[model samples]
Target chain A: MDLFISLFINGLATGMLIFLLAAGLTLIFGLMDVLNFAHGGLFVWGAYSGIFVYTWSGSFIVGILGAIVTGFVLGWITEKLIITPVYGNHVQQILITLGFMLVLSECIKVVFGPNSIPVDVPSYLAGSWEIGEVIVIKYRIFIIVIGLVIFGIFQYVLKKTKIGLIVRAGVMDKEMVQVLGINIKRVFLFVFMTGSAMAAFGGMLMAPYSGVIYAEMGMEYAILGFIVVVIGGMGSFSGSLMAAILVGLAGSFMAYYVPYLSLAVNMILMAIVLIFRPQGLFTNAKEG
Target chain B: MRHEKYFSLKNLTFLIIIIALIFFPYVADSRTLTILMTQIFIFSILAMSYDILLGYTGIVSFGHAMFFGIGAYTTAILLSTYNNTMMIFLISIIVGMIFAGIVSFLVGLLTLRLKSHFFAMLTLAISGLFLVVAEKWRTVTKGNDGFTFRAPDVFRDRVIFYFFVLVCLVVVFLVLRRFVNSPLGKVLIAVRENEQRTRSLGFRTLHYKVTASVVAGVVASLSGSLYAISLRFVNTSVMSMDITLDALLMTIIGGVGTLIGPIVGSLVIETAQHYLSGLANDYPIFERWIIFFGMLYILAVIFFPKGIVGTVYVKYLTWKSKKAKPQLPTQSVPLVKDKERFE
Candidate 1:
């Protein structure tokens, strides 16, 4: 029972981290129909920049803020320079974004040097709580709380805000939203920036959670994010959360029980899902 | 009906090129150049196989390395465990191609129905699964540590190996060209242009796509076998994403839809990589050659989206048409008379 509880918590924490990355990916794909392969680059940048700030300023809050800012600036540049030209062409978008992804990864190696950096959990969130036989780690709980709070905040904003209405409308029918005289282009830029910020935010959080940050981690986690997005359904917010949790739990349990099949498990799950639900589990029926 | 001419300028150019390549080893005594040329031939075959999907069929797969790795591992295991004879090598290549074809056929049926984005991600995931299996199956694969093996007696000589690979490249290229020019190839092109229209016309686009996937997979496996034989080694890195990306880069840089483009692309890329990495000894900046590669990739997509061969072909056509414009006035008089007669 103790092992199960700890495993469950571990899965939930990892799920939240994946959700943070997938959320942005889904939103960007949903609203703009732009598959940003370079999203991973934004992620690693966030980890590096945020970690740099954290060490320099000796404040985690400042690091998080710095990461978000880096995401925004990078997102804006990527959208304007790389994505704007290949807006409607999927092939061009894939090729260009992949190129940009390579550039982003190489740039990280250039700036941070070609070594993985070890990250420490801050003093305030270091210990664990013991309840009978169950010992709960504080950092894991902190990540879960942060994920839930962010999810709640985003849900509130998406449900109630004017920008949320426009975004939802854009996702449904961009032409219809444009017919209503909204500048859909601006909305695209705004959504791209927000999604990138979320990815960077996830990266910043993941750095300490994993205890080591590397340039290549972006690609590794980005694949996880892509899997979550596919399982969850493109552009479906709640679906992403649910699918991410499912994947997280599956990965955690598989690692413990069938160690050899740990990595293969995710691919198997994705293949099963693809076979059954081509449109994805959470895809809107109308869209399908 | 009048038969088409067989000895056109294009045919002559190709024949000359083939003849020149057949004698290349004799003239070029430099062992490094011979090896480099051999590597280019192998990669060119791989890139051509990719072209059948990305260029002819409009499918973008990120898991092409899986087939390549399958070919390499099959040959490696067979030659190392059993007799290192020509017969075993031949059987291994055949087995690898068949295995790749079956896997690609199944993968196509499962994921080709999804949108391009889904297909790309699923292929990547599937390839990653293959990588994991290769890494963990240490008993057979020897895992990431990898193992080296002796080549067949015939391929032990570098000159013989070079000629052998050159013949394979030429044969594969000619076969693929004929495949693309056939009626079935035309249907594949139609499917790429507009799948719904092709389906509405009762072509069953899925069958054609699966066929292309299998063909591409088979050819890619052959290249993989050749690559392993050339190196006389096998490793899990053969299944890595980098191999797939290299193939993708080669296809894109040469030309997507052009059969000859991939050959040129492999030549440009292989030479560039060799020289750039070699230059790392002298210039410290060349240590990060991938950054330069990425920049070149981005520029290619932005400026030369059609690729080197594709853009040049387009330019040649436009020039030919301009040159023929003077003869158009003579033909216009008949059209004017036809209009007058109709009125």
Candidate 2:
């Protein structure tokens, strides 16, 4: 029971992180119709920049803010320069975004040097809690709480706010939304920025959770994010959270039980999902 | 008259390139250039195979390296075990082709009918699955350390191997050219242009896609086999994302859908990589040469979206039409017209 609880918490923590990234990816894909392969680049940049600020300013809050700000700026620039030119062209979008991904990853290496850097959890969040035979890591709980908080805030905004409604409406029918006289282009840029910020924020949180940050970690985690997006059903927010948790749990349990298959477990899950539910587990049927 | 002119120019360029490649080994006589050119031949084959899917059939795949890796590993394992070059080479080609065919068929069946991005992602996952297995299956793949094998005497001589690879490349190029110009290839173009309409035309689009996938896989595996022989070593990198990306880049850079364009793209990219890496040794700034390549890639997509050969081909057509009096559209002209949208 203890082992199961521990694994479950571990899985939940990782799932939350993946959900943060995938939420942005699916949202961007939904609204902007851009795959944004460079999403991973934003994640790694957040990790590196957040860690850099944390190490320099000695304040985790400042680091998180800095990372989010960096993500927004990068997102704006990428959308204007790289993405705008390739709109409505999936092939060009994939190729250019992939190129940007390479450039961003390489830029990280250039800035941070070609080595993985270790990061420490903030002192207040360090250590663990023991309840009977179950010992829970405090950082893991913190991650889960933060993830849920972000999800709740976004959900509230998405459900109640004007901008959120517009965004969702845009995802459903961009032409129709534009016909209603809202500058859908501005909304696209805004949504892309917010999505990127979320990805960076996830990376910032992931740095301390994983205890080490590297340039290539973006690509690694991006693959997981893509898997989550696929499993959750593209353009479905709640589906991302659910699928992420399932993938997280599956990965955690597989690692412990079938170590050899751990690396491929997410991929296998994706394949199974693709085969059985090609539209994904929770697709927006109306759009499809 | 226009058809004759176009064919003569294309034929002339093809003949010149083939003759140059045939004589390159003897003319250069430098071992380094020979090896480099040989690598180009192998990759050109790989890129051309990829063009069949991306350019001809409008299918985007991210797991082509799986087929290439299968070919390499099969060849390595066979040679290491059998110690007979002729039999091992023959067996590896057949086994590699079959293995690649089976995998592509399964992957195509599962993902091809879905939206394009799903197919791309699933292919990536499938290739990554193969990569993981290749790394973990220590008893067979020897894991990440990779394995080495002795090649037959024929392959030992760089010049003989160079000519051999060149011949294979030319043969593959000619065959693929014939394929793309055939009636079936036109159907593939129609599918690319409009899948729904093609299905309404009573064509089994899925079967055609599957056929293209198998053909591409088989050809890619052959290149992988040659790559293994050239290196006398096989490793997991042969099945990596980088290799797939390289093929994609080459196909895009040379001209996506044009059979000869991939060869040009491979030559350009391989030469760029060669010189760029070499420059890194002299200038510290060039240490991050991949950054420049990334920038170049972005710029290429923005500016030269049609690719070098593709752009040049368009220019030639424009020039030819300008010289001739405006005439009624013909079949060949319409085919060229269909390709213009990619630009």
Best candidate (score: DockQ)? 2
Local error of candidate 1 at A10, Å? 1.0
Scoring the B chain of model 1 against the true B chain gives a TM-score of 0.93
Docking class of 2: medium
On lDDT, the candidate that comes out on top is 1
lDDT of 1 at B205: 93
* DockQ computed for model 2 against the true two-chain complex using alpha carbons: 0.54
The TM-score of candidate 1 is 0.95
Q: TM-scores across all candidates?
A: 0.95, 0.95
Candidate 2 structure, TM-score to reference? 0.95
List the candidate 2 regions with Cα displacement exceeding 4 Å: A284-288, B1-9, B326-343
C-alpha lDDT score of every prediction, in listed order: 0.89, 0.88
Candidate 1 segments whose C-alpha is farther than 4 A from its true place: B1-4, B326-343
Q: Can you write out model 1's per-residue Cα lDDT over B158-211, one digit (the tens) per residue?
A: 999999999999899889988988889889888777788999999989999989
